[model samples]
Target: MPRTLVIGAGVAGLATAALLAREGHEVTVLEKGTRTGGRAGVLERNGFQFDTGPSWYLMPSVFEHFYNLLGTTTQEQLTLVDLDPAYRVYSEPEPGSAAPHPVDLPRGADRVRQLFEELEPGSGPALDRYIASAKRTTDIAERRFLYNPFKRLNNLAVPEVLAAGPELARLLLTSLERYVERRFSHPVLRQILGYPAVFLGTRPQDAPAMYHLMSALDLDDGVRYPLGGFWEVLASFRRLAEEAGAQIITGAEVTEIVTAPARRRRLGRGPRRVATGVRWRDEHGVVHAEQADHVVSAADLHHTETALLGEADRSYPESWWEKVTSGPGAVLVMLGVRGELPELAHHSLFFTRDWTANFESIFGAHPSVPTPASSYVCRASASEPGLAPEDHENLFVLVPVPADVSLGHGGAEGQGDPAVEQVAQAAIEQIGQWAGIDDFEDRIVLRETIGPADFAGDYNSWRGSVLGQAHTLRQSAMFRPQNTSAKVSGLYYAGGTVAPGIGVPMCLISAELVLKHMRRDYSAGPLRTEPQRTARQSTGSRADGAGD
Candidate 1:
């Protein structure tokens, strides 16, 4: 069996190891931290288990597909609980209004349509039109672009894709902000449609209208949570990888990817790329070298290219990143609250009225944390009470800021670096005001803040970006970095930084892309795996990433 060494034990890395191991390759995964899950890590404190990363579970079919590929099923591995009133959108107070406008997003398409119609009179038809367009774009993206390896242009020349040329062109050419504004007049509705851009690592104004597909997932599909938070999902991945006979070792920090010069396969071609092994330091700080026929770096793409490989073997060096745009950094505040935050829903979004100001504060020339930053709050205890002690809540607040580690690192309670504390405190205040949690701060029994610097220190994140690269038209789809290196033939990559883009589903698809590249199976769509078992009935109550 050919030996494979996968760097990092993030979702993508574990998925790749499991898939490759099933193909008879001897896979060994190296994780820098003491535990797996990479960005989807857990924080346990005083009987509360907080999911510090990637809390929202958006795509169920995608997870199901992955489990099927692993000779299992989502039902067999996961207990998914549908979250009613999927999420509540907390918008800034209306003129003369004493409180903020909180819209509880309902489940199913018709109710969602009705909610929008209620919000903006005579908007039901326009909302339907938008959903149709989103569905079309989503269909095209899933069938053609998301899984396409870009090995051949002909791969995407299917009849439906050919038919969508004009519509697709229009979507790609326009901005998400323009797309929403053309259809909806309500400011909150626009914010709802535009916010997904942040998840993609760009402002809505800069993100291509093609991403309107996110609405298809957000509204139509509704949101759900895995029983134990995202940590449960990570546990599933690790379990599958182990069951497939892949070895995973934590605290094995890789020093360098070993490589050497090699002769070209054809006389006309340049020197053939090669990665023979890797040099790493184990938990004991002892350096060891291990040989592998293939090396997959699932760490941050920029770190893999610039830090691990030699200058001679670098496919994307420092000069290349000078032109690359990083996504926003973030200050994540994890709190174990004393009481049931009845005012807050399972998921709440505090959207500022000045949406452009918030986006500019993160993406503009002089990026800084907005005074009343638009943020996301996930109260896991709302759905999974087991995550926290009885009568308490496991909550996390994410405030997007500039991708700069200089803002400082995180620490326990009132001890965080001043800048990070400023951001986190402001978010806490904003949440209390917008969500109507009168004594939000006083209820906090535990507090831990994660800032941009922590991402750099823990994950070697380039520019301390929480997500990977910004998903501008220039950095998305085929425009993003490919899975394999142009300079190192056997060195592959799998993570949020490469295509098909950020988020958990994208990372799972990225793992499959590596499988496609290795086996030369460059089909346009995801490979079909026979159904292992039909998903059973619901039991309860859902990014590959650096520090989600």
Candidate 2:
């Protein structure tokens, strides 16, 4: 069979392996981490379970569609329960105000409109129009933009793109902040509408107005939480991939990609180099090599290109990455409190009145400076009963910071660093006051923090960025990294860094895009039955090919 080696066991890697294996290709996945999930990993400590990353499950249809492709339903795999209040937003009190303003974003569109009307009279109708426009953007994106790989200019000439050209142009030209300002008069309402930009790791003013579709998806479709945690979704993907006959090896860090010169006489005018397999080291520090017909990198795109493939085999130059605008990194604090926090919901956002200062701090000129102006808190125990001890809560707090800030590798100085501690203290104090928990710090029995430097060590994230490249107008769609390698044949990439951009839904779509490109470029033929040969054996006894 045509053996394929996939790097990383993240959502994209697992999904790609599963889909390719189902297509009759022998697939094997290599994961550097000890667990299957990359950022969506689960952590258990002191009887409290926490999701390390991706707490908000915004797009349900995406997960449903993935499960459906595997001949099953998301309902069959995991029990997905809608968070009733969706989320709660707490704004810092205005001058002369007695307390902070807390807005509960309830499920259902009519109820959301009611809430908007309460905030600003006559805003209900405006919200209706805004959501309608957002829905149109979503429709156009799903039908025309998201599904296609955008590998060539001709891909933009489709009928759907032609039909939505005018609306798309308007959305592309406008900024999300500008759109929200034009649609809503109230500042709080504008913040609520524009806050979804952070999910894409960009400021509202910098992100395209088309992202307002996120608000429609959030308020109309509602947010969901898989029973147990977000980790359950990773488990489901792992199970599905394994069932599809794909082998996954955890704690196997890939050192280099193995490639050989293509047989020019047999395949005319193909690339000079073709990927043969990969060389990786296991947890025990033992080295091993696996041979395959094709290789897919679902790991960090920058690491895969520069670190594994080296400068000579890279399609993008060092200057290209320098120009890429990466998304914000984060400072995450996981707390296991001894008492309940009834004021907090399944998800909550603590926003400061000075949104501009906060955004600038995150995406500013001097990124290394720490800013703890806003925070996102996820009290998963509010919805899931077994997540924490009785009468206690599991709190996951994240502060968006500039990707350039350092917290020492693996958070070596996280506990004692003055800057990191300052941010954590600010977040804790704000959340405690907002939730009416006066003794919040004392209630914490266990605490863990992850900073940008930790993200670098753990996930090899570029500049410790939590998300991949920002979805700026220039960094989006066809402008993003291509799925196929330009310098080497049979080498492909799939992840947040490539086309379709960031988020779990995008990762799944990225895998499909890679598969589509692979089929188109290599031609859909039956798997070759010849046994895989070592790179040394195939390359005329070149023993040097054995090591990276």
Candidate maximizing TM-score: 1
lDDT of 1: 0.88
lDDT of 1 by residue, 1-548 (tens): 99999999998999999999988999999999999998899999899998888999866777878888888777677677777788999987766775766899888889999999898999999988898899888877888999889999998788898899999998999999999999999988999889899899999999999999889886898888778788989999999899999999999999999997765666657536688989999989999999999999999998898889999898899999999989999999999899788788899989888989888889999888887788999988998788899989988889999999999999888698999998888887777777778898888899999999999989999989999899999999899999988888789999999988798889999999999999998888888998464433323211111111
What tens-digit string does per-residue lDDT give for candidate 2 at 185-266? 8877888898888888899999999899998887888887777787988888898899999999999999999888876634
> Going through the candidates in order, what is the number of backbone clashes in each?
5, 0
Q: In angstroms, give how far residue 316 of model 1 lies from its true place.
A: 0.5
* Model 2, position 274: C-alpha lDDT score: 88
Task: Choose the strongest candidate by lDDT.
Answer: 1
